[model samples]
Target: MTRVKISRVTKVPASEAPPASGECPPSGIRLTTDDGDAAMGLRVVGIHLENCGKQDYSVDGYPLLELMDKDLSPVQGISIVQGSGGISTGTGFDEPARPLVLKPGESALSGLMWRNTTESGPTANIPYVRVRAKQGADPVTVTPQLDLGTTGKLAVRPWTRPSK
Candidate 1:
């Protein structure tokens, strides 16, 4: 018998993330993403938020995400679930969101998860995402290029402190 590797995760360090076109000012925070990973058709992209302000920054719950097309218009018919929702077990997204206060230069994380399987109808290829660290927060656009192949659902993890 032989064993073959079926999945792998690709981590893109924040220091090396490609330049994104989104910008939000006066919020004292910055949003960026990793290159993303695909494990056996399950896609995961890490969303990172850092407090770059002079004072402490706080957030609780998941980051609000609005999927957008290349034109930056909202994409319809897609569902954003809070947890894995059975999409895949053992994903880190299952953890509950807790309130976090980050000092300047500290960072927190969340993630976008989905599976691309085209069964019927058209596929969704999102070129941009409008993200808010919390409700009523200013929106910042990010280019993750989500390739949702008719899955019609995306899951998000809660904001959490990065493990030391």
Candidate 2:
């Protein structure tokens, strides 16, 4: 899991600013990976977002999740499957904002799908998920590697979430 800080700008002086109510610093946000599944010539990658702060947080745009090889090159035939179908692959924006909200200590799950189109066999690559809380906020990228064994077909279970 990778932690990232949310960016905030305030005009109030540090001393004069209101004390933190329940909100957590951006550092409390985390990106994690679940086990992936490959079956019936299809690959499903599990992605997760964890909020460990005292307050809730929201993701502004489509969660940036990509499948890439060890050399950091985009893997062919892998694409993020958006359930909402509102945002296109390029823009990453929706007509109406569909922000994902996670309360403190809560986690959200997303999936990416790919088909093994090669004739040789199943190829091994890494799944990476990038997240940013708001526009102009610093983004964090987390890539966790899992071994699915050598086979032309693959099936991986999602990783278990850590206990609080």
Which structure among the candidates has the greatest TM-score? 1
Model 2 misplaced stretches (Cα beyond 4 Å): 1-26, 66-69, 73-97, 119-140, 144-164
Q: Which stretches of model 1 miss by more than 4 angstroms?
A: 1-25
User: lDDT tens digits, residues 30-143, model 1?
Assistant: 888889999778899999998877899889999998887766678999999998877898988899889999998899999999998788899988877878889987776777
Model 2 TM: 0.48
What is the model-wide C-alpha lDDT for candidate 2? Answer: 0.46
User: In terms of lDDT, which candidate is strongest?
Assistant: 1
**Pairs in steric clash, model 2:** 5-26, 6-26, 34-159, 35-158, 35-159, 36-156, 37-156, 38-154, 38-155, 122-152
TM accuracy, model 1: 0.83
TM-score of each: 0.83, 0.48
The whole-model lDDT of each prediction reads 0.83, 0.46
